[model samples]
Target: MEIDYSQIKVIGFDADDTLWVNETYFRDAEIAFGKLLSEYETINKIDQELFKMEMQNLGIYGYGVKAFMLSMVESAMEISNNNVSIKTIQAILDIGKDMINKPVELLDGVETVLSTLSKKYRLILATKGDLLDQERKLEKSGLTDYFHHIEVLSDKKEKNYSRLLNHLDIKPSEFLMIGNSLKSDVLPLINIKAHAIHVPFHTTWAHEQVTEKETNGKAYKTLSSLKEVLNLIH
Candidate 1:
């Protein structure tokens, strides 16, 4: 289980559930959304449809609350046969506004981990989703000073990481990524011959879930807490 960090020069971190509370808000929003459409469909059905709607609209709307807002609106229309009241539509928009306005809640040991890690290795924040929202959260989180570079990616596939590393003049061997989602943060780096660490959050979006077979032989470290990272990195 021993891995080398001696050659690692830059560390890329996924900003969502890894650093702050994110998926939980989305989960709460889904419950709110289900209630908004409760008269039209059951909560379980509404939840499934909303996820499907999001998957269908991901390419066009991208990620973040704005995208989820659109999906909710679309799903409402389809679920309600376009008869959703204007008042209900207004509530849906308000839901997104509330999400955007919510204060950033940093995870335990986040500041300490970043503060300690940034001393030696270069630290970069590489999160996926809307740039504006990510920027807003970073500003609110008061952790902006920790990063040398901050990027909001449309997606987090291997190609995206490759392009980012190349742009930063970082060889894959010298870069490491740390995050909650295996699909977005860990496997992509592993595939590209970079190191990654998995720090699982309590709630993961369905899209971020990966099969056991996909991770069966992946070379990455998993820690119970963000604080645990300090033990290995130094």
Candidate 2:
């Protein structure tokens, strides 16, 4: 079906893994964390425990490296029976810092796509993460000027996107969201009767994975890369 986007007045973009490299760092952190506690548990166990910790702390920490850092600390404490060395704990903190300080490596065609789309429609960044961290990354990304508004959301759900529509003074049909996560970026918008485009990243977080049944009959387009969006919208 040709989903008409001529009525779309606003386009919401997810930041991490969509605009720049994100999950890769978290994956790297996990690997580093596993090595730190190699003596405590197997790598597989550490991975499972760390993910469980992140999920448990999601409500309290929301989403971001800071939260992930805390989860890592807590998991380390538990995995090591609270006997993990201070130096190892310090190493985990350092891993988070290194991730924060890492350069904002923009995805391929991100700038070209954003610059071209910005001239045609109202482009906004609707992402979920630590506000300060997101803001800092935006400042570093050099693509901040391409967006008119930046919303660091607590979560990406129907109500959240609906509030965004109300704030933009647009109906659901007039708003289109694009991102890599089907769970967070696509399904919610589709459920709310809004348009969404899925741009699958190389690696998806386990939390963002959706069952085939969840997307069985949804009306949306999935593109291999953000570059293809221009061809679709144009």
Candidate 3:
């Protein structure tokens, strides 16, 4: 279905995978984590249990590398039956630090897209993660000047987006969200009567995956790259 962008006055972008490489590092860290715990369980089992632990602790630790690191430590202890070595725990911390400190690599056309879109509409970053970590990445990304506002949400549920839009004094019909996660970025906006465009990244965390049933009849546009967003909104 064709949608209208004529009413869009504020365009919000998801920071992590949508603007730069994020989940890839997390995947690499997960592989390293599985390798560290290989003695306790198979790599596959370790990966599964780690995901389970992350889901369980999401409420307590929230999102981002720090929370992920805590989940890794807890999962390792449980997997090893409290027999995990201190050395291995140290390795987990090292893995998270490595991820946190990795260079911020922007995806293709990110700067150009932001630069062009910012000139046309008020641009805001709407993303969820560790506040310090997200701020660090934004500082490193060199794209901070393009945004009119930056919001680091705790979660991207329907209520969260509604509250943010309301706080910003933006009407739902006048807001557009662009991101990779259909669950967090697209569906919620669509549910709240806001516009959304999906830009799929090569990798997505398991927690962000959603069932098709939840997306049935959802009205939104999906693009292959951030560059294509210009075609829709302009």
TM-scores of the models, in the order given: 0.99, 0.99, 0.99
Question: Counting only residues 3 or more apart in sequence or on different chains, how many pairs clash (N, Cα, C under 3 Å) in candidate 2?
Answer: 0
Candidate 1 C-alpha lDDT tens digits along 1-234: 788988999999999999999999999999999999999899999999999999999999999999999999999999999999999999999999999999999999999999999999999999989889999999999999999999999999999999999999999999999999999999999999999999999999999999999999889999999999999998
Instruction: Write out the backbone clash pairs for model 1.
Output: none
lDDT agreement with native, every candidate: 0.95, 0.95, 0.96
Please give the RMSD to the true structure for each candidate, in Å: 0.6, 0.7, 0.6
Query: Judged by lDDT against the true structure, how good is candidate 2?
Result: 0.95
Off by over 4 Å in 3: none
Q: Where's the lowest-lDDT run of ten residues in candidate 3?
A: 111-120
Clash count of each predicted structure: 0, 0, 0
Which has the higher lDDT value, candidate number 2 or candidate number 3? 3
On lDDT, who's better, 1 or 2? 1
> What are the per-residue Cα lDDT tens digits for candidate 2 across 1-234?
678888888898999999999999999999999999999999999999999999999999999999999999999999999999999999999999999999999999999999899988989999999999999999999998999899999999999999988987878998899999999999999999999999999998999999999999999999999999999886
